[model samples]
Target: MSRFIAFFALVGLIGFALPRSAASQDWQLTDANTFAPANYLILTIPQDEPQALAALADTLAADFGVSLAAEWSLNALEVHCFVFDARNVSDVDGLITAMETDARIRTVQRLRSFSLTEMFHSDPLLPLQWALQSMRVLPIHASSLGEGVRVGIVDSAIDNHHPDLADQMVDLFDFVAADPVPLAEAHGTAVAGIIGAAATNEGIVGVAPSADMVGLRACWQQDGAPGVCNSFSLARAINFAILNDIDVLNLSIGGPEDPLLTELINVALEAGIVVVAASGEGQELVYPASLDGVIAAGQVAGRSVPAPMVDVLTTAPGSAHRYVSGSSIATAHVSGVVALMLSQDPTLTSAAISERLNGSISDVETLPMLNACTAILGPSEACAL
Candidate 1:
């Protein structure tokens, strides 16, 4: 298994060079601040003569008073993407309005960012989690500890060295800063703890304790603030997950409708990778979750698991353990259960898995929650209710 530190060093040493734009500016391959607001715009220009493209960049820079931050060509798509940073943040709308009229530009829009769905909470540990018992996790684990299953966490940076997560992590990719071991944050670390934390005697056991985890950091977090992720970083991470053949992808975040991200997730689903996401707060579902083929998890005391598992322990940054709440954590629990199902029967399709999970819910009022043991073994073979 490759550690995040090794990947970070390798990224630094073997950095790939980007083509300079016609404006005579070197392309900015990675953003210095991933979570910052939309001071930048993504412009799609038709592929043309190098001089023509350069002249266009120069003209745009001069007219709009913007600077080219990054530029890349998609030869197959016959287009070039140019990222420009506006000198005046407030001028973004004006610039977009003016650029939309230019005949040469294919598409232009201000970059959009997404966010984690979890709410942070810290408290003293309670020995047993109600969720674990409710789901009959132990009985399912008797057959499979999610061995050989890979769960991709597409969220904020995770604590790579946390005692509960250190050994469960199989890989790490930081689209946020491109660091090998992305900066750890509260949300991702907690979500990861819910899904794949190690079953060490000292800490809380995770839903799929032995499953493999790949922390793809598309989001960043600041102290005492919610984690944030933009479309470009998230698209890159999801593309990576698809290319790498991840078994199950957990998206413990929510955002508005986005065409680019929707398509990437669609491709992943079509490729037979199970994609799970938090259903946004309220009655309506968010993008990706609202899109077809995704298991939308909600926190209604329920396609979801129990919320406020007061005893549901999760890992936090700085190697600390704490309790967390929200639809994001519920999504993680579902992802973990999926991992367990996949481990036992790698051939199960996403639909079949969903049916088994929903069908196995033990009657607990109108609120439906997962029953892992019954989902894995037939209800007849499952542990007695």
Candidate 2:
């Protein structure tokens, strides 16, 4: 592996080159922020390049006697939408029924919710994360630290003040509400640390420490420590990625099969963004991850340990770090590696990257663990296929 480092070094050193995006992406919720409103449904209308979006907004606002609190556009489908707040659940259902019969309307549905990729808070003292080492991340990092790549983490807000992670946060937003009521910062903080905690010789280094970090907070604490979000919130974050031309979008959260969320992911993929998702434990896959054309990630079933035990160590919230385990953690590993690859070649399409990853690694429990070095050098020369 060190030889691989020498090879990458001669070719420009394996120190990843990604850096956080500009502050222009940094935005907080304002009164105009349309998501997270109560007793509301999203209404869609077909308009190819909506020449008169305000006119349509006025029509909906005037006819329904409601405010046009927020709006979004599905460029892939050539339609725009408005979020409308109804008085009660009955009114929401009745409005949906009435809208379904309207010839001018395209799509309408009640808002949905999604939960954080469940993670556990463990003791600070833990083993080194082998997931990164196993992927030959050192060689890749020596060549690039995922510089110039923009990764949108759609979870709870990250620790904006962590010494190791503060500089990497180029932008942040709360999609669920004006501001997410942080329940446990460790989960999102840990994920951000895994993806790109700055290499400041601090508690722990991140996978792509220099890569640009964009906190797209779509989940908020509802009843437990883990954050939860619905379809509407998820859609808001995905649309942000598409509109802003984000390089990679990380969906560490999962829930049931949602049509709106599915369509939004499709839009992101079509716009040349690489989406990495986490699969739930066990053979059964979860939504978003189960969606085809996505790079689904999970832990490798190690030969020395029982498959039931998860022992991955990564970044946590606050000043102290912790050990957390789940497919969510594993997905972060892949995401970090993707950033490195993108840093080297921004034009590399998602399909080509997926082909190299899926085709290069030899089968390990029918789901091969990725090797970052091999992905860049081509499996035929650097890895076992």
Candidate 3:
């Protein structure tokens, strides 16, 4: 575990107040340049060989024109992963192929980008929140407030000062900026509001108002554009969640399948952390959600491919709220339900929670609705009543 200690030391303080190494600052600026998939490639080398790793990085720089942008030691996977900023887009495919044949390299992958599963809509009647009625959230709240459960909201920066989330946020970390005081963004604030915003008379209430929420800003939003994240940033946040003893992780983002991200997610699952993610837009489930031992959730009203749909009303940045719809928003509600169950029992596995939710789905709604009351308090408390 000494290597794990070294890993954390390299990551800086506990709340991910990372002191960026020279290499890290380079990619931060590169990723900052545009939200489009970063021109970076991910590869891994053996652990405990700093000299060998540096030499390999130099060899790649000399042999292929790519330079190390950032590196993190994945203790659980027993490999040190590196993200290289390719000078040319053409160099990426060739570099990955060339690296695969090297004895020093354990694995190599092209970086994949991901985005939040939410779309914002303006509707005056959204304050009524029909989705709450569909889920029977009020009755479900009678049995559980998700008291004391720690849920990691792995998305954009949440507005910690938003009235709904002010008292609920336990911690905040910005992997995008490597700063503790991350700027509030719409997507993350909305997800936090849905999962565990403080219940108040003035604003909309969350599904599990009493759960402890940790705002982890892995995805970044620029100029009101949708929030986006790449494999390097996602892996860091997931690894932080796994090592920090976070009880539940809410990932409302999706992308193509990634090996490094998958390894980190599997580690979290094996450690008894329940991971909930948004289901895919098409017929298949996306990465992270697509992985085994993860709970895949989609909108109760169905996805928004062929039709424009209204989803849930939740918190937004700066003392506001909005109606957001998508498998992304749906994942938040499901995560809140999991918090409710965990708050009561504290031992439910992802599989058990999934089974409970599936068994309790209501047939009354044209589209299947999660019977939150029955899911939390058992079949006798079915929402059909």
- Best candidate according to lDDT: 1
Q: Which is superior by TM-score, 1 or 2? A: 1
Question: Which segments of candidate 1 are over 4 A away from where they belong?
Answer: 1-126, 178-182, 300-311, 381-385
For candidate 3, the per-residue lDDT at 197 reads 71
Judging by lDDT, tell me the better candidate of 2 and 3: 3
lDDT of 1 by residue, 1-385 (tens): 2111111111121133333334343444554344233687878898765767778888988887888776667555667777788746577788899889988789998755432211111112313556766676766765788999999999988898898889998888888784354367899899998897776445667889889999999988887699899999999999999999899999988887888998899999999999988876666677677777888776543334332333467889888987777778878988998999999999999889877876777654455666777888876423444
- Prediction 1 global C-alpha lDDT: 0.75
lDDT of 2 by residue, 228-255 (tens): 7788888999999999969989888878
Please list the residue runs of candidate 2 whose C-alpha ends up more than 4 Å from where it truly belongs after superposition. Answer: 1-127, 179-184, 222-224, 299-309, 362-368, 379-385
Where in model 3 is the C-alpha error above 4 Å? 1-127, 179-182, 299-309
Q: Which window of ten consecutive residues has the lowest lDDT sum in model 2?
A: 1-10
How many steric overlaps does candidate 1 have? Answer: 1
Candidate 1 colliding pairs: 22-54
Task: For residues 1-385, write the lDDT of model 3, one tens digit per residue.
Answer: 1111111112211122112222232122233223223477778777644556677778876776777776666555676667777856575677778889988789987665432211121223324766666676766665678897999999998999887789999888878874465478999998998898776445776778899998878998889998899988888899999989799999989888899998899999999999988885667777777787888887423321111124578888888888888778888888888899899988788778878877777654466677787887775523553
Q: TM-score order of candidates, best first?
A: 1, 3, 2
